[model samples]
Target: MKVRNDAYLKAFGENLKQLMAKSNKNAETVAALGGIETKQVYRVINGEHSATLSIVYAIAKGLEVHPKELFDFTFQE
Candidate 1:
């Protein structure tokens, strides 16, 4: 069975990449701040793997941003 939610992960990954770029932070720095390995960040950024809530929370905290900011939402009328 697929454990990771693909759509959410993909969106999250894209947003994370954008955030990292905007912050001028590399994978190594993000990994250190999130207490994860650099490879994990690479995988997520590449959309090859998904991150758990713990990882997401860590990233948000490390970035000093809210989790909602990591998402791009669209509401239809």
Candidate 2:
């Protein structure tokens, strides 16, 4: 079944992609750090699959950022 919160996954994927680019890291490296497969990283980056809490935490730890930061998007007043 598809995830109900697809937008969250999409946003998270975009943020992860940006973070990876900023860190000059590739999918293989990130996946290794996260203990996940490169194909899983590709799926997350492509927004074709949803990330579990464990994966999210791993990514946050790998990126050296708080997991909450991944969901922090401000709106203009």
- TM-score of every candidate: 0.72, 0.73
TM-score of 2: 0.73
Best by lDDT: 2
Tally clashing residue pairs in candidate 2: 0
- State the local distance difference test value for candidate 2: 0.75
The residue-by-residue lDDT of candidate 2 on 1-77, one tens digit each, is: 24445666677678788888888888888878878778888888787878788877777766667888666753222
Q: Give me the overall lDDT of model 1.
A: 0.73
Report the poorest 10 consecutive residues by lDDT, candidate 1: 68-77
Clashes of each: 0, 0
| lDDT score for residue 45 of model 2 | 75
